[model samples]
Target: MAFLRPLGDTGLTISALGLGTVKIGRDQGVKYPDAFTIPDDQAVRELLALARELDINLIDTAPAYGRSEERLGQLLTGRQDWVIVSKVGEEFENGKSRFDFTPEHTIASVERSLRRLNTDYLDCVLIHSDGNDLEVLRQGTLEALAELKRKGLIRAIGVSTKTVEGGLETLRRADVAMVTYNLAHDQERPVIDYAAEHGKGILIKKAFASGHLQAGHADPVQASLDRILGTAGVGAVIAGTVNPKHLRENVEKARRAVGDL
Candidate 1:
């Protein structure tokens, strides 16, 4: 499979590197070290095209990512060619964020995501936890997602958790877990270890520490990804970059890091 890795037992394979679309949709409340303007539709179209050319198939978006879902729905083509992953529970509007984990909202959120993404189904839908990962899990979001999977709305369900306990619990009940992991943050390494042991999918978020770790290094991107991809259970690192050069650099570095090129 080269750089492609299995996404747990969900029967999906993702690349070692994946494109994050937040820069294409929202920039107001982001934490990137450098500020950026939201790319136009044409820019996003080209980005998606380049991603496909690089053999990157995973796309991560979320409701809290402002207009990301709507933009992807309008711009992304050949739906079957991508393994789309989106999130529910957090909503961003007018530069503010809100959370609702009720089962009713979960159902409505997935339905809304389907409409916004212009797809009948999503490969995975994660609970966009509000830092209270364990509490949010108990509020029926997982059960709701399970039902959605049964109904063919989402193939897999998981949580973008902020804590190790939540990560472990998510793997026990779901197919994937998105966690924060980077050179500066090894506190979550235990979560990745658990996923590795249990054959569960683990997607790495903040792989570059939200642009914090890239400064003051000769090649911090390579350094960060080498450490991340070298780990046993990581399925993919979702990095956001609207610049073509940066995107290509990330993919190339990630490919080299995987050592199967």
Candidate 2:
């Protein structure tokens, strides 16, 4: 495997293929809610160890992902070389989820994330967007992130946007941006191109489009990823998998893409 890829000119670099721990300890079949089963903690730990052995450094998780952060923390104890990235927004309640990004809630979420991840500082913290416009992008939240960065609580900050326009707008202002792209929902080319051109790291989510590609629909996956990587600003792609074999398959795909590059 390769070492790591720089997210931007800001000296931040991570593995090209990150492990999304949402399904590691939390409920499975989350993408298809009717069928859900959480994995054993020990299995999740072994998975983390395996990823590290493979030299995969970045582990992406979210507070809403039940015990994912905690599981990763347990698995990654004493491993400081790994880059842990997490997001804040969306809370779980009554077997449902709610979104909240007020300044106070964001800070609280970070605190909880720190405790859960058992980490002193997060490598990156992305603002979880609810598909909202910039009007809801809080100045206080940005200020809080700036404060965290200043205090060394977070190494960098970013936003999770669902549209190319929003991603571009975030790239224009934020240090990094996570956008949805893949064979299933490839709609952020312009923003990704701009990010690549301007030295912004573009993290891709939903590469498989919630199991659609895994169901023998590989063309869209290949074509979409090819198109995104061909664009300017893409930094790394985060594709989640609960199955180890499938995870390795995703890693192979990433390696092939990078090799072609």
Tens-place lDDT digits, model 2, residues 1-261: 243778886577787788887776557326743453566877776777777776688889997777788777776755577888898876655556688878888899998889988888998898888788474464466567767888899988878887666677777777889988776565677877787688887888877676566444445656555655555567778877666776776666676666633
Winning candidate number (lDDT): 1
**TM agreement with the true structure for every prediction:** 0.97, 0.89
Clash count for each candidate, listed in order shown: 0, 3
lDDT, candidates in the order shown: 0.92, 0.74
Model 2 stretches astray by more than 4 angstroms: 1-3, 32-36, 214-224
Superposed Cα deviation of residue 165, candidate 2 (Å): 3.2
Badly placed stretches (over 4 Å) of model 1 are 214-217
- The superposed Cα distance between candidate 1 and the true structure at residue 67, in angstroms, equals 0.8
> Residue pairs in steric clash, candidate 2?
195-233, 196-232, 196-233
